[model samples]
Target chain A: MSTSEGGDSPGEAGGGPDGTGDSGGLRTTLTRTRAATALTLRRRDSLSVVTGVTVIYLLGYLWAVGDLAPGFGGYGLVLAADPLGGLLRTTSGPLSFAPVALVRAGPLAYEASLNTLVGLGLALLVGLNLGLTYLTRKQPAACGLRSSTGVLAGVPALLSGTACCGPVVLVALGLQASGVILTAFQVLLPAAVLVLVGSLVAVGRQVRPEAMAAASGSGARGSDNRE
Target chain B: MPRLTRRRTLASLASLGAAALAGCTTDANTGGGGGTVPAADDRLPLPIEPPALRDAAVSGGPGKDGIPSIDEPSFVAPAEVDFLADGDPVFGVARDGVTKAYPQSILAQHEIVNDELAGDPVSVTYCPLTGTVLGFDRGATSFGVSGRLVNDNLIMYDRATETWWPQILATAVPGPWNAEPETRSLREFRLVWTTWERWRGQHPETRVLSRDTGSPRNYARDPYGDYNPREGYYAGGAPLFPPLREDDRYGPKRVVMGARAPEGAVAFLKDGLREAGLLSGQLGDVPVLAVHDPRYDTGYVYRNPDELAYESVDEGVEGPAGITYAPDRLPLDRIHTFDAMWFAWAGFYPETDVYE
Candidate 1:
């Protein structure tokens, strides 16, 4: 959780309660990290591409599998893995960028797919958060890291984890979270999703298309490792 | 960190609200009624110390019908259930000469199978949590999960009256019939858990419940963790929720065969039956007999022939021709009996006798 929302909604956002009022620190860290990312935030190849992919993924995932539990059947998310769970499956094998819409994914299928999608989103955010923070520290002011919103942007990923992963996390923390907390963890995803969208837009705003074009064309390409 | 604080207090209060809301969600999702469901009320007439001790049901989680029940279930002949391994458990009921077997694999998901046997409408109810399979005469009505639990036992509701009936107690409580003379306990029948091979062999004409239950279900995939060898959730001592009455005389999860008489109830350890083969005992003033059928690996209770009102009719092969079974075959006048977890049986009927 970014320190921004901790005080307002303790368990709604992220991190420990003691971390409240650290938004300024979070901002300081985000700015410092965003400044170093080699991939320009708004570049046709960087944040823009990621934003487009994320948007498309969300739309397609919901379109195909959303009906299984419209608004999650008022349960937020479910994790169905029964083989008789009909069409939507996410437990085994590699996943496609988009899930195939089935006539009906049954009750269990809806739960399994939601868990998979949310779980995968969390993993990606963690990786992006770590990789971006590293670049900011390594080459300050050189890459998009200083202006990148990935760290704050990825805070919503905790909501995704909270949806299906709250119990495991809380159990690990040795905290006997109430059902309400567990439910809130999943219930708050829509709000977290909204926060995520805003962060993506902010990240996209920082992309300097011109700088990205120049870096790509000139010998400066040596300075930017695309992969 | 003092174990209580404003944040903690607010959080606890919020959680309580959530639990109540969860009950509402269960009510909404299950479509059983139009009002909010009280989370854990178990004030049934029982001998337990705490008549209704319970935990608040946490919601925003699986609600009633959230896991779903097999209301529109379909069945198959013996051939379709060829997948049954030797060790698998099945609940078999023979009535009016026609016999049917319900695999635990199927029961593991949908705990209630409302079907007719020998033309008699019955609800074959199983609660994996308590390890009980009880047959109830629906009396032309149907039963669904009330989405409530008493001592972690399945609380069921009849569609007609919407009265909540805890499966173990088998009586209506806290519903429209709360003040009624006697809690309407459903008339139970003989339901034995045995091997599929033995059930099919005893009555090869037996129709096994099918996986094609009109809904997409992993008929083979078990929702509750594996209990076949008791190496999963069944292997542990933890219970989802404790029953109101607390007793440790029998392990909470130990399987015990129980029978109730007009006077009181009694239980026999499965091992006791496995060893004794045949044991005669008295429940109330009436004498009862407990026998172990090694072929099916189950214990059966019946009224002792000496005290039986009449002789159990003998039918050569099938049963008494029509939909009624020949009571004389096993010669145990079959009564509504269940094999339940020791803790659950003892929790509800603390006055029950246990055969060592």
Candidate 2:
């Protein structure tokens, strides 16, 4: 009955006795993920990895969607007549919300859009995955699993930020856009979130808590024990 | 005083062009449908019916007012512009003693700019997909991008009537907001498609559209592609959308000097005009001439009913009594022409007579 937020105990979070049942495995995955994420944030090296990747990915996302780019040198701010109303409006392509404000710093201008928040969410997921990957790699005892999903999943999230005319990649690759391709483009953002979450769960479930605690020179909580 | 002199000269030329093309006008009224947007007296030839064109309209990734029009466009002196490169394309317009240049880079982001030229309201529109920049008299109302495209051209809707006006067609087409509206063409003026260096060189005192377009967009980054070096979508072989009619005579992205009237539509290959300096073509049964302007690297189409043998000379074009006139100002009646990508012109005007 304990949802993902409060249920860090392996037995309660894992629904079935075997922990391999479909529902049980998902719960176990969630419990392990929370513990692993806490460890990631608590450790200096893993936290650094998360911070660096998130910032880089966010900036790259902004640049790809063209919300951030080099501009004529000037400093100014422009707010749309109706910022709140504009937030719900889409621009350029699907899921690409209209920018409500323009902020210009010398040599650079950025359009403030809801997509930035979307990108931030994706970036955090990607960064967490990478941080988990780092923890697994740095301490072999922590987990025997390794994954490149963090990097791979980040690609679609970046492409999901299509520009005003069409998909920026399509334009760059000189590929003709068809109905099927555009439809596929529309699902990219959601697809990325699903992939990142699945990858994170897959990565987290492998982290043996007792081994991770030993690796980090910390005490393992009885609730976090998976064995 | 010199600016005033040049403005008067441009006004005179515009008047002469309108008067000369008046022969193409008839009793046909592309009705304004009681709209504030001014309707042209002559009904331009539409490839398809108004309702059908409306049916063919497809969403270009935005909704009404999605690609916001610069309602209160601000401009700066050419010297104050640092965002534009020398070769960046700019749409230069001169009317009522005012000269202004709208950079393609900036307009690429915002398709429509509702601004004033010497107290007269006008909309400067650019379609990145079709590579067309058109200027229309807005009358008392302004225009906005409908975020819908027909034949890969920007569909502008008037604020007053909300009727769809495709940039290439310049004619009213029924839209979702106001179906069954009048089928009328707009009063269009020429927006010279020239490079920033060329436009600035010709009009030294010209006001350049500043990066201070109230809406915050990365003006330096063209979502469609680059124009100065011609890359990405601008240089692509295939159009983003299928054309209404397909003609393989020229590449889809090839730029052509296109002019249409009630009589018919005609196009001259821009490169061919540049090379030959002068080319003759036909709009339906009437004879027309395309004179290349070396100053701005643009072409002007004129109605030459007499088949006048005017040759391109160093001064401009030599005509009656061997006196030379500017390429933009020939003795013959001028047809309102603007540059368009070949596919757009052919798609919108399938019967167009092309001079390559």
Best candidate according to TM-score: 2
TM-score for all models, in order of appearance: 0.61, 0.86
TM-score of 2: 0.86
lDDT of 1 by residue, B246-298 (tens): 66776777877887644456677777766665555665445666656666667
DockQ comparisons of all candidates to the true complex: 0.06, 0.48
Per-residue lDDT of model 2, residues B1-356, tens digit only: 00000011223223323443563432232224543676676657777767888888887767788788898888999888887889989999988889999999889888899999999888999999899998988887788899888998899998777888998888878899878776667888999999999999999999998877766567778877887798888986788778898988789999999998877788888998899899887776678899999999999999999898898888899996799999998988899999999999889887777886
| Candidates in order, interface RMSD in Å | 11.6, 2.0
- Give me the runs in candidate 2 sitting further than 4 Å from their true place: A1-26, A74-85, A139-152, A161-169, A217-227, B1-35
Q: What is the lDDT of residue A182 in candidate 1?
A: 55
Chain B TM-score (each prediction, in order) = 0.74, 0.90
Per-residue accuracy of model 1 over A1-227 as CA lDDT, tens digit each: 02232232211221223234568445533442344243544233444444554554444333332223322011222222343453433211112111222232333333233444654464444443434433333333333435445566666655353443333234234343454665565555556666554554344233332333343433234534332
Please give the distance, in angstroms, between residue A120's alpha carbon in candidate 2 and its true position after superposition: 0.9
